[model samples]
Target: MAGILSLVWFVGSVLITPFLMILLCIVFLASIGKSLGVRRLYVKLLLIIFEFGRANIETAQKGSNAEDTSEEDEEHIEEISPLNSNATNDIKHLKTPNGLKKPNNGYVPNGNSVISRDDKLILVPEPPFTMHKTDETTDLSEAKDKCKDYDLCNIFDYLKAGMESIIEDQVTSRFEAEELKNWNLLIRTNRRYEFISWKLTVMWVCGFFVRYFFLFPLRVTICFFGVWWLTLCTALVGYVKEGDFKQKLNKYVSVMCFGILSNAISSVITYHNEENKPKSGICVANHTSPIDVLILMCDNCYSLIGQSHGGFLGILQRALARASPHIWFERSEVRDRHAVANKLKEHVSNPKNPPILIFPEGTCINNTSVMQFKKGSFEVGSVIYPVAIKYDPRFGDAFWNSSKYSMMQYLYMMMTSWAIVCDVWYLPPMQQNEGESAIDFANRVKSVIAKQGGLVDLVWDGQLKRTKPKKEWRERQQEEFSKRLKVE
Candidate 1:
């Protein structure tokens, strides 16, 4: 019994000593915002794996195609009729993927028309109204002239437009996960290429074990450590008197804490235009994931405003509030727009406070587009510092689909992902122009962010992800349709 106890103690010390050393190393390196180039090397290895997977997938596809050459040719011939061939050519001309055509003359729906699409019900306007908007509106007189006769042929264009939308929708897809161009060896992605070859299959199996059994446990430990560190450190800082020293200490602690959290997902962020970083004002960015807060906080400390959450998020929020003034409104308090605005105004008014980060979209987009920006932040009348964050989907999908996944589930996916790679661009500060309405200013800012992030600039509200279209929008569409039906 004595010998067994001795062996057990010896084994335990041997296992724990290295772990403790690693833990200390990570904490020290993360506190100073320095890495040992390990993450970059890991990323390079992932790229090599992806390249191997792509080559294997291509080879498998070529082999299968060679076996079914005659059948493939027949299917191709049947799929591409003269009309569809012309459409395909036009789609190619527009450089659209997945047979999606965004012609110079295609208009996205804006509460104007009701052409429904596939398994899902999405309404769009018929052409020439479908034409893309410009400084000058395209002459719809010819379209009106054809509609004047009220012939069956006139309705065919609507059917055609409806069918096109069904095949390749431009709107609803934005709320869903962004489709990958190539498989990233992750099962969650829409693309699956794991079965392409035996070697590829072996690699995927190994990757699964590595991610789930090895990486997941390590990441969870790091994340929990970060949370505890943040909670305890902020609690201590909360006792400090309100002064420059307290503020500086809080900022340093916050950065280090968030930096540790970032390492949990192996995030590799590339920040641009650091010179434009906001000192003290409203910082607006497109929302893609809750980690947007974590990502931003890692670089610079900011006072965050959001609806109060429970569980893990609640703990962090409470900790942050204790250290600094982060405005976390209860669900009931959120509906009081004026009260919320007042709180924001109060926070921004103080010169000593750090910049307040706000996501004006109000919900997460799929990282493919910038949706409508809520104008409340713009109405604050503060200088707007636009920060554009674009994530590389090849590394990991940073978008949080709140409707599908819970917060914990989303975090699990993020942990198992290869890495969270993103670029953050801090744009020049903007102010609402004299006489410019808040909505217009919001849109202008949204456009700048969309352009900077290489995302589609959309006018649709992201809240439409779960909610129905507004009654006012439906009424506007009806009004426009009634006017179109009447003789002008």
Candidate 2:
């Protein structure tokens, strides 16, 4: 194939007049002249060298005729080899100039042996010139003394780093837009991405002010009133009818009322399989935010079970604890998981009990996926009812990344949005299959919920998603330092 391609290329080049001129000139000279173009000069040079060599040989022969035969024979006898192959091999390697010696090749290098003791030991030829070198060793003590005299710090280096960081972050910022999209409903409808998209910088700035100054006051007022109204009615329910049939009615009613108030802010709420909503039994739901409670309880009230969150939400949970059957398990009791399970079992002792709502993902996810479920809720021998909740972030992101904002901060951002839209799916009751362990049962329930709600099923245990803000701070500074170096 190579020969064929070469032949075709040669023919193509010969077809051109300039290529033919160069090619034919060389061929014609080589065929008819005494020598080819370069060969003609080489022949003249060789003849001159031959003449010089012959004259030198004649002069050497005339000079050597006076030399004694006896001295020549004695010198030859001393220099001759004695059938030693080892000495012959050394001679072979030594004859080849610039041959490097291996450390353990079982041969004396450069004939550094008795046979070549008188011979020069020129292993490698001396270099033409010595390289000019500057001293590079750093003296810490001297440097410290110098620094003390003039306060010589790395401020210049720091300035260079910061400048590089600013430039690098600016240059690459355009490409780091929300490249992964449409993976789930969350990503498909994320409007908050305006803050990140390079093309939407101006629009985002405008939206920010419009969101805060124009729409902030009205939403906060509504949220403020809803909080108090929900609190009072909840207190009234608990006080009027505690542990009776009327209490159940009041609890469900209060939840529905809270849901209605929340729905007023969002302007959109819908649910499926409202009939399968349980009055009492273990109820597990996918959690995305604190608002998940209101969404799930829109139709049926369920007692929440989890550790209490801090801040405004924590206070709200505490207030609700006095009114509803929401149980905040003590997280410090690490040695008493079995005791905790027993307590959980006791909570659902009654069939008429308000169905205990368990957000198995202990922490909220970004609605990209349903995170792993804690098996404690499924461990109880009750029929586990599964619910899937999904939100449309086209109007607002309901997933609260609390690290960047407080509860009030997040809620204000949410309420002032165009609207919060969501869907609830109350999947069919999932019972533990024969001999299925609690983890297996929980996973089964989680998979069904993820499938039903168009959510991704992630394998991470949500409990392990605790924010390491302190560690990440150090890492962030290091990352910034590295970015600066990269740009430089």
Task: Give the per-residue lDDT digits (tens) of candidate 1, residues 252-288.
Answer: 9999999888888999988999999988999999999
Shift of residue 137 alpha carbon in model 1, Å: 14
lDDT of 2: 0.57
Pairs with steric clashes in candidate 1: 105-131, 106-130, 107-130
TM-score of candidate 1 against the unseen true structure: 0.84
lDDT of each: 0.79, 0.57
Write down the TM-score of every candidate.
0.84, 0.53
Best by lDDT: 1
Q: RMSDs, each prediction?
A: 5.8, 35.2
Q: lDDT per residue, candidate 2, 1-488, as tens digits? A: 99999999997676455533533453343223222324235334434533443344334434555365446544544454453545544444332211223212333322123132112112111111111122446554443343333222324444444443343321122111111211111223233333333333454466557556644654554456566766676666667655676666566555545653563354456678888887788888888788887776666667777675776667667667766676676667634778768867887887766788888887767775676788888888888888888776545567776556787777765766656667888778878999999999888999999999887565556644454325664675556434423411
Model 1 worst lDDT window (10 residues): 107-116
